[model samples]
Target: MDIHHLITKLREKGHKITPQRLAICELVLSSKDHPTADQIYKKLKQKFPTISLATVYQTLHLLKDLGLLLELGFPDCSARFDPNISPHIHIICLKCGKIEDYETENLKEQWAKIVKDIGVEPIIQRLDLYIYCDKCKKNQ
Candidate 1:
């Protein structure tokens, strides 16, 4: 992801893209790994030694509030961050703790049908499918 484009988008959205925020945005947007606030902070701190952990936490919340990031929940205590806002599913590797995003357009249709049949509105805030990935399973 181009950091300049991200900065431009944030500015266009009326978000003040501070230097620290820009760094955080660059880190989160460019990452394929669904990292936590602490993980982001630790990596970012290497480049920007002055940045604080509290700032990282605040930036995470700000990006989430702006709909540029998603908070993924799991049985594990920490929340994970995802940059993709499009409807998708996450497959969590139980052993390695890796989160991979998958897009299945048909799943939405199936969900819609299920909701219609059940006569209930679906609160599809996020979807996470937990499984032991092949590598993890093989290691066992």
Candidate 2:
């Protein structure tokens, strides 16, 4: 979702509109890196010197509750948030912790078949493929 839509939703929910909150929303929604809350706090703290990590966490959680992003959790690592909530695959680099999105029509078709065969209703669908990125592979 874009900044304007986000702001409107916040307003509808009776949330206060703050510049810091706007910055946090822009920072998270503008990138595809799927940064963790700590990463976002560290980066924004540079711009808004007085910004607190708690603020970043709160904003992120608020957006999450609004269903505007997807949160991916990894073992022994900080959870990464993705603004692109479409059904797709997340390729994570085991070596560098890089996250990339991948989507294929074949996979979508297969998933539909699986659901039809099982005859079970589903709410959330996600697939994460863990692998090393080309740069990380070269380094290794």
Regions of model 1 farther than 4 Å from truth: 1-16, 112-124
| Candidate 1 RMSD computed on C-alpha atoms after optimal superposition onto the true structure | 3.0
What is the TM-score of each predicted model, taking all chains together? 0.79, 0.88
Question: How far off is residue 82 in model 1, in Å?
Answer: 0.5
lDDT of 1 by residue, 81-116 (tens): 888876678888888889998877797777667668
Best by lDDT: 2
- The TM-score that candidate 1 achieves is 0.79
